[model samples]
Each structure stands twice: as structure tokens, then as C-alpha cells.
Target chain A: MRELAKMVIVLTVLSSLSGGLLAMLREKTQDRIEQQVLEFVKGPAIRKILAGAANDPIADRFTLADGEAKRSFFVGKYDGKPDVVAFETFAGGYGGDVGLIVAVAVDTDQIVGVGVTTHNETPGVGAAVETDVGFIRQFTGLDIASGPKVTKDGGSINAISGATITSRAVCAAVGKAGDLYKRLKPEILKQLKTFSG
Target chain B: MAKTVTQEFVKGLWAEIPPFRLVLGLCPTLAVTKTVEDGIGMGVATGFVLVCSNLLISMLRNVIPSKVRIACYIIVVATFVTVVELLMQAFTYPLYLSLGIFIPLIVVNCIVLGRAEAFASKNKILPSIADGLGIGIGYTLSLAALGAVREVFGSGTFLGNPVFGPSFQPFTFMVQAPGAFVCLGLMLCLMNLAGKK
Candidate 1:
């Protein structure tokens, strides 16, 4: 009984100590990690998606609260006005959660571009979705309020050859982003004023 | 029978080196030595975890119940690995991306648990630090040496720069998995030959 108590106490104490240290370290590194993500992961994707924008989209960003979570929005100015906004959304994919960044023309509520930010999909098959230019371009100019779907699901978009699941994941992420955008459109527009060049 | 702190430190560089002499922690040793940059990055990250965990484990050795020592050591090692991952993601995003899944896998690397169990658990704090530092540096040196050989022969470049003239042809086999095995074997043989005297 004494040995059992000692074991339990030691394990409990060690786990909690480990947990506490991690939690504190996470809190301290959260902002810097977020910044690094912007500079590395999101930066290239956003720059490519929001191409030709007069202002740097990555440097012009803001966050708005939706419910329990805060979502960041990157602003792109074209012809000296903050006309476009971009954000990330996720959905289940072939390997795990697939992250897709969807950019929208705020005035018309039309998708300007779509890009994959992170994924664990199969290398040559599902991963081809990133470089599959024609498929990605189809998302552009689509109505942001209307949920987009692949052709098999009775939508205009065609799925990538041999990667229907990953294609569907991207569609699903855009659909979820549509719902999020509709809910937060008012707050997003209000925040965009400050970023306008 | 008493060994000084200097001896403990020196042994890690050659005698009891984690990967070569101890023949431990071969996974990262095999996977990340494709480039000198990547090899050094993996080594530094592993060394940091090994040292931090060793220090904390030695400090807590007296208080931890022997029955739950392994569990306690894991908690400590895992916590430090996570801390390293978070910091890398924040400050060295490129290295973090290049190293990928291996950063989190450091928790399972036996060198850490081996040191905690064999050395830190019974030794004083200073010697434990020495052992961790020595083994860590030795591991780093071994990996860098292998990385240099592979990079120079495989790609005809050293650290991404052309080491040979432009006319030189790269031995592509040196960068592949089979090459890693052959290189490691030959290096191991050489080490054995040196130690035989």
C-alpha cells in the first residue's frame, strides 16, 4: 500500500509539473509562433493568391472574434483600396486535417483565390492539388456565400484525378469558410477601414 | 573508481558517444544526414533536449520514487522536447519545417532516457550536465561528419555550394537511403579501426 501510494503520487506530480511547464512555455511562444507562421507558411501562399495587390497582404492583417476563437484576416489593397481579404480554414483530409487558405474580394463576396497551407495527403496524388493550377483557378470568382462542391457532388468544380477525398476536403473547408465569412462579414468590413491605403 | 567531471564530458565526444560507440539513437542519425545543415540542426535540437532533461532529472532523482522513475523521466524529457519544438517553430521556422516530425520524436530517442536512467538518476548535477553536453556534442560531431561526406559526394556540393568544379558529376547514390546505410557502415568501420589500437 505504501509503495502504491508513492508510485501514484510521484507519477501525478511529475505529469502535472510537465504539463504546467509546457502550458507556460506555450503561452510565451504563442505570439512569436503565430508571427513565424505568417512569415513562412502563410506568407508565400497569401502573396501568391493575392498577387498584384499594391500593398503587402501579409503585413496588413487583423484578427476578429467569432465565438470562443479569434481568426486572423489578411488584407490586400488593389488600386489603393483594401478590396480583398484572406483567411484559413480546415477540414478532414486523406491523412489528417487539410488547411486551405481562401481569399475573397470583399465588395462582391467572390473568391479571388484558393491555396493549400498545410496537409499530410499522399505525396504525388493528393499533394498535386497545390500545383494543380486549373482546379485552384476554378475556385476564383465563385460566389463566397454559396458553398462550392466537386463535380461528383453535383457542383461545377472537378476533383483532382485520383485524389477525390483531398479535393472534397478542400471544398468542405471553403464551405465552412463561407459560413464563417457570412457570420463575420460585418466585423471584417469594419476592421478593413484601418488597413486601406 | 572515481571519474572527474572532465572525464564524463570527454567520454561523450569519443568513448561513449551516443550513436557511434553506444550504437544508440540511429533513427535521426539515418534520416537527417542528407545535408550538413540538416544534420547539424537535428544534432543541436537533440543535444538541447538531452541536456535539459538530464539536468532536471538529476535534480529530481532523489525525490522521485524508484518504481515510477521511468515515467517521471519521460515526463521530463517530453516536456523539454516540446519546449524545443515550440522555440524552433517560433524562432527558426525553416529548420522546424525541414526537421518536421523528427523534432517531436526526440522524446522516444533512447539516448535521453538512457542517460536519465544510467547516469543522471544516480549522479550529481554537475556530472550529469557534463555527460549530457559531451554526448550531445559527440552526437552533433558524428552527424556533421557523416553529413559532410554525403553532401560532398552525393550532391557535389557542400552546404548547398559547389565544392567541386561545375564540370563535376554528383554521385546521386550518396544522397539516397542506401547511400546513408553504406556511409554509416564505412564510418563505423573506420571508428572501430581507430579504436582498435
Candidate 2:
């Protein structure tokens, strides 16, 4: 009984110490991590899709409460006018989840451009989404209401060679983004006004 | 005593290297070696956790009851892993994203637990630190080497830059899942042949 008590006490103390240390570290690094996620992971894609914007889209971003989830939208301004918003959506792909950033011109309700933000898809195949800009560039000026699809599905966007599954996955993500844009259009517009000059 | 410490550190380099010799921690070995960048990043993170956990485990070895020792080691390992994860996400988000899921998975990394059970639980603080450093660095080097070979053959690029001209068609197969196994096997065979001499 004494031995068992000692073991239990030791385990409890060690666990408590571990938990306290981790909690403190998390608190210290929380903001810096969020900033890094904004600058590195999501920044390049937003900058690429919204290239002509006068302001830094990553810095001028906001989130909206959608049911239980908070959705972040990067605000892009062109000629000092806040007119574009880009956000991420995910789709199941060949290897894993493929992340796509869909940008829309708020005034035009048209996709400014679509960019690949994150993916674990097969390298040299599905990974072309990041390597091959032309594949993503096709989404520019696409009508969101039309619902973008691959050329095989009677849409204008061409599927990456030998990576049709990934291409379709990206299309699915874009389609989801379009739906989200429609659902959150009013909230997005209101958020954009706050960023506008 | 000094000789033993040196021995512990050096053994991890060639005699009992993870994935190569010990055949330990093969998951991260295969998963992160796609790029030299990711390989080094994971190796260093694993090393940090290993070193910190080993040091703490050694320090608390006597105080921790033998029956509950495993639980204490796990809590220690887990705490360090969380610290690494949060720090990486804060300072290096791109690397963090690429190494996603794997960071948290380090808690279960056999290397960390293996070292704690095999060496740290019985050793002094200085020796534990040495052991961790050796094993961690060895793991890092192996990943970096595998990453270099795979990236060169698979993509004809060295760290995302075109090492070969535009006409150089990449092997493409070298970066896939089977490619990782095949590459590691071939490298192991070479290591074995060299060891024989």
C-alpha cells in the first residue's frame, strides 16, 4: 500500500508540473505564433492572389463568427479602395487535405484569383498546385456564381496533367469558397468597410 | 566516467542511429526527409525535446517510483514536445506548417522514450545531455542526408531552386512514399557495406 501510494503521488506531481510548464509557455508564445501564421503560412498566398493590392492583406485581416467557427478573411485594397477579400478552404485530396485560398473582388463579386496555400498531396503530381502558378491563375476573373469546375466537368479551368484528382479537389475547395462567400457576403462587406479609406 | 559519456554520445551517431541502425523513429525519418529543409527542422526539434526530456528524466529518476516511472517520463517528454511545438509555430511558421502533425507526434517518437528508458532513467545529468545531443544530432544528419538525395533525384532542385536546367526532367518517383523506403534501404545497405570494412 505504501509503495502504491508513493507511485501515485509521484505521478500526480510530475503531471501537474508538466501541465503548468506547458500552459505558461503557451501563454507566452500565443501572439507571436498567430503573427507568424499570418506572415508566413498564409501571407504569401494572399499576396500572390491579390498582387495589385496597395495594402498588405495579411496585416489588414479580420475574422467573422460563422456559427461556432471563426472565419478569417484577408482584406485586399486596390488603388486605396478595399475591394478584395481572400480566405482559405480545404478539400480532401489524393495524399491529404489540399488548402486553397479563394480571392474575390467584393465590388465585382468575381474571383480575383485563387492560390494554393497548403497541401500534403503527392509531390511532383498534386504538388504542382504550388509549383505551377498557371494552374491557379486560371481562376482569376472566374464568376463565383457559375461555380468553378475542371474542364472535364464543362468548366474553363484545366486540370493539372496526370493530377486530375488534385485538380478536382482544388475545384471542390473553390466551390466551397464560393458558397461561403455568398453566405458571408454581407459580413464580408461590412468588414471591408472598416478597412476602407 | 568521461570516456563513458563520450561513448554514449558517439554511439548514437553510427552504431545505433535511428531508422538506419536501431530502426527506431522510422515514421519521421521517412515522412520529413522529402526536403533537406524539413529534415533538419524536424531533427532539431526532436533533438530539443530529447535533450530536455532526457535531462529532466535523469534529474528526477530517483524521486520517481519505479512503477510509475513510465508515466513520469511520458509527462516529461510530452511537456518538452509541447514547448518545441509552440516555439516552432511562433518563430518558424512555414517550417511549422510543413512539419505539421509530426511535431505533436514527437511525444510518441520512440527515440525520446527509448533514450529515457534506456539511458536517462539510469544516468546522471551530464551523461544524459551528452546522450541526447549525440542521438539527436545523428538523427538530424541522417534525415538531412536522405532529404538531400531524395530532393536532388525527385525534383532536380536543391532546396526549391532549380539545380538542373529547365530540360532536366525530375525522377518524380523519388519523392513518393515508396521512394522514401527505397532510398532509406539503399542507404542502409551502403552503410552496412561500409561498416563491414
- Each candidate's lDDT (Cα)? 0.92, 0.89
The model with the greatest DockQ is 1
Question: Per-residue lDDT for A1-197 in model 2, tens only?
Answer: 99988988888888888889888999999989888977877788889878888988888999998789899999988889998899999999898888888898988888898888778888888889997878887878888767778899888889999999999999999889988889999999998899977
Model 2 residue runs over 4 Å out of place are A89-99, A118-187, B1-4, B14-21, B157-197
lDDT string for model 1 (B40-97, tens) is 9999999999899889989988888897788889889999999999999999999899
Question: Highest TM-score: which candidate?
Answer: 1
- Candidate 2 displacement at residue B3 in angstroms: 4.0
lDDT of 1 at B16: 91
State TM-scores per candidate.
0.86, 0.81
